[model samples]
Target chain A: MTDPREAGFVGRRSDGSLIRRPLSPHLQVYDMAQMTSALSIMHRITGVIWSAGTLLLVWWLMAAATGEAAFAAVQWFLGSFLGLLLLFGLTAAGWYHTLAGIRHLMWDAGRGFDLPSVYATGRAVLIGTAVLTVLTWVLLLLFWN
Target chain B: MADGKTVHEAALRTPLGRVRGLGSAKSGTHHWWMQRVTSLALLPLTLWFVISLIGLAGASYAETLAFIGAPVNAVLLLALIAATFHHMAAGLQVVVEDYVRGELRRKGLILLIQGGSALMALASAFAVLRIALAS
Candidate 1:
């Protein structure tokens, strides 16, 4: 019997290399099947957003260290419309990442792996992030007033 | 004499074969450890940061400088910056590895995140030192 690996090949190149083999297990063709999949994807997405936010944190720290004029510039930007939008997004990402991290910790400890519990907790995490983000902003506004 | 095994077979064999302690990548422990460590550190540091920001808000530049120039404030500020950046770097590295599939791209992004955080931390520390030492 012909070897399985060699059965499909018509011929080899002059240099004796196998020609144009198909790559297996393409990611583009796979479907996200459940809530867990969605959360896993979002976890990575929020991570990038959090990374960008860290730069802002550093900027704030450096500004605080500098004198009045420099610090004022940082304040002005933060208080502006665009800055507010970014801050809002960052806040949401922060809460989302925090909640997700807790969920992962639970999984690591071998809890919440069952279907019903996983789905329930996943939904809770999604809703919790939004609620926490809004509450944070509300608290900020109330206290800052 | 036994027939010579192929290259793949040779690679599979070892002096301590089968019973050796060699195992899969164990870096998960490191990641888990750092995440918890940073989270613990950030709990207090973050609270201090928010309170400090709120207190300093709307204050004049000189007054703010004076507040930071205080030894205790300066030291705390430095510690917070260091811990925060380190935590951020670790978090970003995981992000890059998860999303960036290509080996070069993933490694490059991780390096950029780490390097950027380091630079920012250094710059912030220098500025803090300047304010603390200035008359």
Candidate 2:
């Protein structure tokens, strides 16, 4: 019933009792320390990662179009340790985002709403992301010319 | 503070009343719908592109260029590019709107993302076309 905008708001809270006002899901009360929360936040984080990584793709494409020397330079960097690490991270992020996207689509269709199914699908997305990432690297190593 | 049943009921705003002139351009439904549509479109396109890349893994620079220069691959590449930037812009707009509290900065970021996406899409398409036609 008390608001900070009101003059007696502080007086009401002086007793250190919880306020009797409607509250939204906020940082102090609703702690997001669960698997579902982790997966949900990871979706946004990975989306940002791979979305930025698209610039790297753009650079690679532009280099390829530029000339042999340009392409060679980009290729050399991509083959280096740092470049490989960056690629690995981007690959993982892209995989996670894609898998999470599938889950989102499934949810859009009114599927997987139960608690057990939600956890199961979240786990599935994580495992799928990891498997796809490793498979991508393995394929690259085995078949890269 | 007379915050009782009558006052609250009288004060409750309708959905449209709340939305109108409440800083919304009213195109959020389109943005949300497009996000889902783009996400759906990316599924097969990305898988196809990834498999294609794997197949190209054993190629030289010229061979890679030749693959991209092919009519079918070039067209598919163009579609992937368009869908990607489109999805990226829409997704980032949601992210920015969620976290960025400053109105000026949020608006600036939205503009930057949309504008940057357009430019990058154009550049990628041009590069792909140049490779495909120059071959």
Candidate 3:
């Protein structure tokens, strides 16, 4: 307890014992009126999902380049129930991550740091992802043979 | 300040000197900046790719080949692949660094991720070239 970390706020209790303290806006301590924390975590989760999604894309592209037979195998799997399920999840994660990324970029530019805008943008990302994922699937189904 | 790094009036070194190496990594922000840069590129590239993919849903092999053979599609596909692998590596590095407590494990995982991303990007780019040039 001789040293203090920058982010770890420590305090002395009434009993004179040292305890790791949390400053303001800590999730459990703070009011739940703002959903920003949940959205922030989801941004990371979807980003991870999108990262894995790149491998699937790579697989598809590799197969397409290989030959007709190779490509057919990939298409067959992709059209299957299991493959389609993964694709559906990827689509939703992709849309969520995409919207979250835009929100992050705005944050980088210092545009949406205000409390109201933060909540608004979080909800917008949720709704946008839902709408966009549905539209993408609809478009794909319309062309499905 | 790092943990257990106590500063006292009797200490010879200033606060800046005491915490010099414990502070920010010199190129930490560069990693952050690159993440942002690649993400910005991905924004439009992904949108285009998704739309093109949907449009190609029912396309025949020959049609798909012809589409990818187009200069614009080939180039964009390459960009998309490059950006994707680049972004993924950067993003994963952050996650691993944040969560993995073992110093050795973190470094090993990061090296693996970077190497794998480079290989995957090269593989995908090579595929695009083969398709674009062969046809």
Candidate number achieving the greatest DockQ relative to the actual structure: 3
Report lDDT (Cα) of residue B69, candidate 3.
Answer: 82
Better of 1 and 3 by TM-score: 3
lDDT of 3 by residue, B1-135 (tens): 234344243355568755563334545367888899999999999999999989898788778888888999999999999899999999888888665655578789999999999989998998889999998
TM-score of chain B of 3: 0.82
Q: Please state the error at residue B105 of candidate 1 in Å.
A: 4.1
Off by over 4 Å in 1: A1-33, B1-28, B51-76, B99-105, B132-135
In candidate 2, how many Å is residue B130 off?
0.8
lDDT of 2 by residue, A1-145 (tens): 2233332222224654434432322234444788887788889889999888888778778877888888788878878999889989988998999999999999999999999999999999999999999999899888776
Report how far off residue A109 is in candidate 1 (Å): 2.2
Report every candidate's CA lDDT. Answer: 0.72, 0.81, 0.83
lDDT of 1 by residue, B23-72 (tens): 23434367657766776676677667666665665567677778878999
Worst 10 residues of 3 chain A by lDDT: A1-10
lDDT pick, better of 1 and 3: 3
Write model 3 residue lDDT over A1-145, tens digit each, in one string: 4322324465556975655665333457755554777787778889898878778887888888999998888888888999899999999999999999999999999898999899888889999999999999999989766
TM-score of 2: 0.83
